[model samples]
Target: MRLRRLFLLLLCGLRAEIQEQDVRAMVGSDVRLGCTYPEGGSFDLNDLFVYWQIPVPGKPNTNSVVTYHLPENSSAGHSDSHYRDRAWLSPDRMRQGDFSLQLRNVTPQDEQKFNCLVFRKSLELKKILEVVVTLHVAANYSMPVVSGPSQDEELTFTCKSVNGYPRPNVYWINKTDNSLLDEALQNSTVSLNARGLYDVVSVLRVRRSPSVNVGCCIENVLLHQNLTSGQPEMFAGDKRSVTDGPAHDTLEAGNKPVFSVLGVLVVAVAVAAGWLCRHRCPHRSHAELV
Candidate 1:
């Protein structure tokens, strides 16, 4: 009866060893999938083996990710062709019940369900631990760049962001009132780049106003990141000149006319001086000759 009870307890322990974990990692970064064997406190190093695999597309059997035994010394392990040197298990960590898999330079394809099984090589390789890990990878979108308040009938502007993962939400805002613009006034496009990242562009059109303050925003929901292109303020019909005040709002619109006036004054002074010298000097010379 005691032997039967111990066998049942071991079975229960094995069942309890299976754990499910979710991990999020950024693209081109290294991440560790947790597969710790907490109850495995007294195991022989020479008799231990660990295997990590991901599900194959069409096969019922899981595809190998990495395998570990001896000679790793916490550094190396045999990995599948797809994983190659980018995935490995540490022998030194395994002895301490840390059989986690380290994946390097994570890509979009690395996002998958992984299975880790640890076995003790006694009579016939007995399974001692198991873990399932789901990896979620994310990449933040680039900062938004807004261009133009070009006028044809309505003022038009374009905003773009590149190399983001999944999709992103775009927003156009009126900075003067800090209010969201009408969605019907804007058009957006999203495309996958060569690296499988998202590229987005949005064009917004608004009616011409006396003073326009507009901004663009992009949000990556997966990464919990938000980027904004600051509001640009332009005056359409303000007649204030720079000479009116130093801090007037007309600096942009008033500087060009100021430059033109200075150019005209320079040409007028040159012509006046030339005409006076030409007419007066010839008359004085002719009088001296006479």
Candidate 2:
């Protein structure tokens, strides 16, 4: 039984099959799909032809990304319009068994399977090799920017993250309590740009608390990466004084001059009453007169 299973496994290995590879690429960046010939076997360019293929959505036919004919020593045809002028093969390394494809200015739509095939023909025999790579594209968004205004007893904060793909999750944090802001206090929106990337914004409104620090956080759930804005503080109450004066002047204004005048008048009246009593008394004890 073991021998039969081993033979089946070996036979399957010899047949053409899909080999998947996961690749992460940022939007507007370049990426390379590496495809090399079978190990321990090499073929001369004179007898080889290589091509790359990708599937088109809602279509039965596969799109030709690029192709090279060794006999002609040139590209056999132009790539699809979407990939034209942006896809190419490494001719310098072709003879060394490397059939890698380089793609430039990639976008979200470029996330798909890339297939590479090589056919070698000789006078007595023909051989074929196939490789398939699955690419996973991702976009990195800019740092979150938080802004807003405080009015009366309410404070509002807005958070924005731009140019990211696959949609991002955005929320607010109250650093004073080490907790995420309640959903009831926040609202968020997302929009796709012309390039198919996402622009996310969130707004948070709550009663003003000057002691708490509020911040915005943006996350790429697919990539498991996150970015947060710097801590922003809130302020409460009407800090402005009535008079347009310096801080010290405002402090001095709180003191009333009428109170100071009244204090002096009370002391003078007490002295006058004591002097009249000393002069008006008809009889007095010796100690008292002295």
Give candidate 1's TM-score: 0.67
Task: Please report the TM-score between candidate 2 and the true structure.
Answer: 0.66
Instruction: Candidate 1: give the clashing pairs.
Output: none
Off by over 4 Å in 1: 1-17, 57-79, 232-290
What digit string (tens of lDDT, one per residue) describes model 2 on residues 151-199?
6556776777788877887767664544566667789999999888998
- Candidate 2 segments exceeding 4 Å error: 1-15, 60-73, 123-127, 150-154, 233-290
> Candidate 1 on 172-264: residue-level lDDT in tens?
766565566777889999998887788888998888665666666677766666666643334345322211111111235424333344766
- Provide the global lDDT of candidate 2 against the true structure: 0.62
Q: Candidate 2's error at 68, in angstroms?
A: 4.9
Cα deviation of 287 in candidate 2 (Å)? 80
Model 1, residue 179: distance off in Å is 2.4
